[model samples]
Target chain A: MSEEKHQHVVPYRVYVIILIALLILTFSSVGITSIELGEYTVAAALIFAVIKSFLVLTYFMHLKYDKLYIRVMVGFVFALFLVVIIITFLDYLFRT
Target chain B: MEHAHHVEHPDMYDEESSKIGMWLFIFTELLLFGGLFIVYSIYRYLNPEAFHLAGEELNRTIGTINTVILLISSMTIAMSTTALRKGHKKVAIALVVVSFVIGFAFLVNKYFEWGVKFSHGIWPGSEQMLAEMSQGEILFFGLYFVMTGLHALHIIIGMIIMLFTIRGLAIGKVTIKRPSMLDNCGLYWHLVDLIWIFLFPLFYLIH
Candidate 1:
């Protein structure tokens, strides 16, 4: 838990590479959604959005280089959000 | 004078705790936006057609350009951290300045985008909306304004933080030895970009 162990500086090259990947993903998301995927449009777009956020989180935000607890907390928060979404939808579905 | 060491130890800067504090605040932000996402989902579900119609009215080209702007700015800010850490003070400040410029570009694009909508009389409570738009369309535009407005607010705040960090870097307050201020600022900016990643698809692309 010492701060000395955590100064792992990310490289500039790595940030540039991640930026290219993000731009490609952004363009692909737009392109894919342009093709009429019908009901799957939202799903496809959301999946791309999720992947983009993961990259931004893991690299740009340095979660990959951070402590284990910070990672765990972030995971838990996202999981909690997913559960909330599911329950809300379920409640919506079962309504009379 | 003998107690000076203990006093300084208590005042010692700790990056780990500082980061934890930031993450905690970020979690609250997640919850705040999560609530909005939930509301959006329910509304869209209740009126899919209206959501679709209103979503189509949005300009995807501007949305895509803004997305790229934000993504590039995010990278520049992240690279600024690396530059600062590597002791390239001038490069670090330069990258941050690039971020500031693109951030302003995004804001400018948003201004015009919102301006177009207003010219079309499509704001949340405009009379044209009350007279002609369906209730679902009203809800769609309402959420659109609120969600994007809040996000733009975050962008402004992030730019302000970057301004301070830019000053810190120039003045030697934010240094390689104590870089939490700049690091935390990067985290905040990336979060804003992350939210836009989702918001772009939800409000513009997924339609």
Candidate 2:
């Protein structure tokens, strides 16, 4: 573990770039809401949000550099969350 | 020599496992909010119009401000970790302090936002809301208050963690070689921001 302590020191420049990208995405989402895209408005905003969270999780949270097991754990948790959401929505959508 | 002897015990400093533990705790936090998000989706589907109306009542400007604030704070916390790793103790502490200040600003913004809502009689169980709002709209406000309120509570908790991390840095308990506490705190702060990333769109930009 100690040997891996020096693991991947991401350059400050990369952090800055990611921050800029996130801010740009944030503004874009806000702008898209005002454009009257009809049904796509919510979908667009949420898509931007998903991208922003992806950046945060991968870079800021250092998941990209984390151990394989940790990555697997995150993926598993997300899968479980998605399953729960889908099943619940199915129940609600089909309720007679 | 006592300090040197402490280093001999490998169990005393397992940064990898400590980080794994933090990640596990973070998963639980995600699921905790995931449940509320599920409820929100169901209610919104059932009452889209009411949810839209209720979302309109929220101040998008304030929400955007808070979003930017949290995003910048997230960057600062991340940079603080980098600074600590680079042996810039003072820079690291200053970054954490900056994040703390921004977090406080977020709460202040929240205070005014909620104050305006309360003054308008939009609070849960208010006679105005109960009498005038439909069941869906009422439920929308209820979830709004509960979800954002919980998120705000997390902001406070994250600040407290930062405070302790700053103290640890000041006293040399946290150092370049051993910064697991600071690192974990940064992860926690990022998690708070991550949650808000979703919350902002769901509640504010629902157009």
Candidate 3:
């Protein structure tokens, strides 16, 4: 067999930890809905979701161990996504 | 980079390049769903009450179950890669199989959930939705079905890929040195879970 290139074996325990954290966040997001936060509810839920995605991307997808170029590529894509969302919101918020 | 340029072996594989290609594909997927999400946001902003009311009609318990199932499956698939790297071929295969089963379970749950909704005449373009629901509510359910349906399609595709990966593993084609195929499949599986992470909160947990 050829030598494994860029082989970075993450410990099994870390995956378990990330999984637990993700589950907890999922529950917390559900629990937060019971409270009467009004407009803040959606914001709070989305924040937790963002954090959960970050964990999945960094750990489960091995982006943390991946090269810098890949990281930059992902970051750019997300940034562009956010910009498009914000621009769309601007139209909705300002239209008479 | 160095190996690909120098080696002329027929079996030569560039795992790094393959991974980059997968990431690029994932980016396109993100943008594709990102467009849908924007449309959801606009409709929600326009008709907040209808969106919230429609969200209440969804079954939270089932949504939570499906969320947990997908998260666990994601872990199993990610760990399968580790198992493969450690040379535990059987364990790795077992983990991938577990992921596949759990993924199927998720779809089954979805089928029932959609069944309940359909029975209630809540489907898009249904006479009940058209006559009874507000414009915003109709739009909400429309996006709901379209987004989740697209996601289910992705899950099915991912499972098919996993099946092939298992076949490769069984034939000794996928080894520690040639693990890129499994790695790419794992990434795709995680992307499915990543999309669900947001979908759960957006569609089910809104109050």
Candidate 4:
């Protein structure tokens, strides 16, 4: 095996920690579902979902180590997310 | 201030461009799904009772297990990419294969779940079955099958790509000198896994 080129690889322990964090979020989201949070239920699930997605993208997909241009591109995509959802909601609003 | 030659292929750019590209693509995918999720949310809000009934009929346990499997497979793919960056060919190959196997396992589990649902007259637009149910409930399952079915198709495509990459490595075409191919394959696999991460909570954990 050639000498490892990059700095020492991130330890598996870190990834395990991320996994634990996701599980905690998952359990908490499920726990909150039964509560009468009213409209907040969707918000809660989306919040946890966003957190989990961030963890996966940053750690598993190596975005944390990526360059700034990449970050900007990803940010732009997320910005589009709002536009798409809002427009969809507009359609829903008109129908109702 | 005079490192002009280094500007052409800086380690930062070279090491990260492919990943950035993958992120951009994933962003578009999220937009596409964001549209779908918004639609789902709207219809569910409009017809809460029907949505709840559909939710009650779903197989949550299987969905959770699949989510766990996909998450672990993602970790393995991350390890594989890291391994390759370090020129650990054997470990990288093994990890890739492991991820592929786990992905296939997910598909198999999903296959049976869908099969059961289909047999139970819960398929997309099964009028003979959903004739009495609210239109929203039928539409909910329709979108469910369409979204997840598209995802599964992507998984199948990813599996085939991984198998080819594995074969490429077996034939000495995927060495460090030509590592971009493997990197791209890993990106696609991770995207598939990422989609499943979102899908799990959406279909299974609906309130």
Best by DockQ: 1
Put down candidate 2 lDDT per residue, B98-186, tens digits, no spaces: 99999999999999999999999989799999999999999999999999999999999999999999999999999987899999999
- A-chain TM-score per prediction? 0.94, 0.91, 0.92, 0.80
The lDDT, on a scale of 0 to 1, for candidate 4 is 0.76
TM-score of each: 0.96, 0.95, 0.95, 0.85
| lDDT tens digits, residue span A12-86, model 2 | 887889999999999999999978898888899889999999999999999998889898999899899999999
Clash count for candidate 2 is 0
Tens-place lDDT per residue, model 4, A15-81, is 6787778777767767776576877876776787788888877877666765567767777777777
Which pairs clash inside model 2?
none
| Higher-scoring candidate on DockQ, 2 or 4 | 2
Estimate, for each residue in B101-180, the C-alpha lDDT of model 3 and write its tens digit.
99999999999999999999988899999999999899999999999999999999999999999999999989897898
In model 3, which runs have C-alpha deviations exceeding 4 angstroms? A1-6, B1-9
- The predictions' CA RMSDs to the true structure, in order, are 2.7, 3.5, 4.3, 6.4
DockQ, every prediction: 0.92, 0.83, 0.83, 0.38
Clashing pairs in 3: none
Q: How much lDDT does candidate 2 score?
A: 0.93
